[model samples]
Target: MNYQLSLTVAICFGLLVLLGYFLPDFDLLILLRAEILRWAAILSGVAMFVGIISLLKVHFNKFMDQKSNWGYSLVLVLTFLITFGAGVFSFIFPQAEGLVDFMFRYVQVPVESTLAALLAVLLLVAGMRMVRYRRDWTTWLFLAISLIMLIGLVTIEAPIPDVFPFLRDWLLTVPVVAGARGILIGLALGAIITGLRIFTGADQPYGE
Candidate 1:
């Protein structure tokens, strides 16, 4: 009974949202869709809050138990508490908003940048390993392009190849844009399929 009720509501809401998109002149469908979307956003916020509480609970317990790799758990707990505290404090007193900004600028941004650097290094290492094992033209091409991009970052007096900057720009503007568009097309198709499946009751991800 509960599953049927949930399925009916989901399908109806999905149809309404679709209708609102297709029939922009209909104020009734537009209003209902807007309200539905707002409620969905509220529910999403609640879900995120629940996830944060669960994450903290698990990490705090691990830290207290002093389990293997507990140091990472400790860092996560302390960082979360400090960030959350600052956010709450700023919410109460807008003048102290700089506390939150400092946490992001000094801590969060650096951490993210460090992770990005490490990811680039890892990708280069992986490319090198692939070259050793495969010895393919594609692998060599990838390595060559990567090298070009890295060299473009250096503070050299002039481009070594004289066309290094142009080549790098062409690579970024052409291949990267094409690849990104392909990915977006795939995502749009997948979203449409997901919506269709939900409308047809082909997928009941809500429950069994």
Candidate 2:
């Protein structure tokens, strides 16, 4: 039954996409695409309730089984409940903007900023390691260009040659960006193929 449903949906979607691409004048196809997305978002939101239950079950199990980081599990549960409570309170008392705004600013902003900073530092370290540890001319060339660009970006009047900025712009706007975009396009194509395979039952998220 699942297979049949999947196959039917896949064929219908495949036909819609093909037809949309072929007949670009009519926007009924585009509307259909948007409608699918709208329904998908609604269904996905509904599915999150099941996800929440599953998450609680797993984390509670970890705490019950006395896992190594049970304290972390307890903290997670506490934070989840507190945030949920705040949301419910906000819904109940829509006029109480102070409490909700304070929690949003104090609790969420700092955590998000800290995570972003950590990610930036990690990326910087990875880039440095690649430049420092690699034993190749291409890597050295990349590192040299990166250093020049960074310096040029930081110091507006650093007495660098006029060509440095030009070279940096070229490196960024021409080769590096083009190569990254090409890779992204390839990755998107691969992902689409994989998703189509899954939709057609050639690949399954769950084991057969």
For TM-score, the strongest prediction is 1
RMSD of each: 3.2, 3.2
Clashing pairs in 1: none
Per-residue lDDT value at 9 in model 2: 77
Candidate 2, residues 87-156, lDDT tens digits: the string is 8888899886477678889989998999988997898899889867787998888778878797657665
Clash pairs detected, candidate 2:
none
Question: Could you tell me how far off, in angstroms, the CA of residue 133 lies in candidate 1 after the best superposition?
Answer: 4.2
Model 2 alpha-carbon drift over 4 Å, by segment: 13-35, 131-134, 198-201, 206-208
* lDDT, model 2: 0.81
Which ten contiguous residues of candidate 1 have the minimum total lDDT? 153-162
Most lDDT-accurate candidate = 1
